[model samples]
Target: MSDHQKTEGDQSATQDSMRPESPEAAAHPRRLKSFVIRSGRKTAGQQAAYDTLWPKLGLDPGTPLRDSRSPGRESAPLVIEVGFGMGQSLAEMALAAPETDFVGIEVHPPGVGSLCLQIQTSEIGNIRIYQHDAVEVFEGCVDDASVDRIQVYFPDPWHKKRHHKRRLIQPEFTAMLAAKLKPGGLLHLATDWEHYAHHMYDVLAAEPTLENLAEDKFVERPEWRPETKFERRGQKLGHGVYDLLFRKR
Candidate 1:
């Protein structure tokens, strides 16, 4: 079997044992409180949906967070898409690949609500979600060598030169992601900002633990990615979009 297939085989063998206990099982139950405790930050329309749906669809305070069940089909491969704005691409990709499990992390209320709605309306059981900072999620919850793929689509470019420090794709953060991914695992990133793309290439290239999968420039956009309205607007304005794929070495 290829290395990817072998990883899946190992995942199946350990799925059951890796299931986490409910949050109530934690030593301090109150610590299990979700970062999304307040919906007030969301716009009225977003809050309305969140109020109506989160209670029913949201995971109980401490339900085992990751999808690790391998009953009928092997638990679909775990793929995490961060900053999935409004969940357009996330919902489309999950529907396109039912065999792949997905976990989405977003801090924006409207986006979180939209994704939750998609997960519910589509009857997609292969996905789960969390409302917290992506950095904390990687550092605290996700296990080493547990994630198969990590996707970051159009993170805020932090356009101002001084604000570039705030961009999500950085050496330190990429290193953290490398530590989280299984060997040979994939990291797929996209951005419309040319400067940001070059910055990403430089940062990733410097990382000895990862290998760039693309030869010359960024690869052609994958068919599976949904062209968001923002991307469309970018195209109309002459801004180019870049996709970068790297494998953990």
Candidate 2:
């Protein structure tokens, strides 16, 4: 996840001089955007969330994020969820773990608006959002070794063989994700695509700084991740789900 990260790969080749995340990121190889901007219209409720709830929950990626918890919960764990589509599972997770603060990223407006609504109806405070490209959010905003958990649930698979380059779980990016975690911090992923699952496994496995929590190829879905409408739809289609959990070494 730039939290559970997209293109689950990233971007149009970007020029540092234009929208640079930081001087250091620009110094690295030019990056390609993996995910496409999805088009969708928001409901009136969702629009309202953006108008009202956003002021409370929205984040500025240019600003450094520190201690992402409510008052007196200074020691709460920090969790990042990348590509949180529609935000139901993420909002549920926040409710289930009030002791943790969740920072969610999604480039799409509808998803951000949907999540904003969830936060309002649920009346949850520990959840915040960055309605921007997750890549820049991580590179520019989140501090290295600051997060306790990073969860990327079902990023765009970019299923076409030629489009595999657009998949998010690449070597350099996986290495960056590893660097974001505190030692022993957890990285959890879930996908319904079997091919993408293997791809995710191989990329994460190759990261020198990460250790797989499951001895086998996959793990049972953990309790914290509520079953999402998307997952249920996949299930009805006979698609299998795979969960992968790893720890920072």
Residue clash pairs of candidate 1: 23-62
Tens-digit lDDT track for model 2 on 1-249? 222233323332222124646777547744754245655678999999889988778787778877444578666799998888778888999999988889988887877888888888989989989887777778888889999999888877766675576678788778887899999999998888799999999999999999999979899999888987667877999989999999999
**For candidate 1, what's the RMSD?**
13.2
Q: How does model 2 fare in lDDT?
A: 0.80
| lDDT of all predictions | 0.70, 0.80
Off by over 4 Å in 2: 1-30, 67-69
Top candidate (lDDT): 2
Q: Each model's TM-score? A: 0.75, 0.85
**Candidate 1 — worst ten consecutive residues by lDDT sum?**
1-10
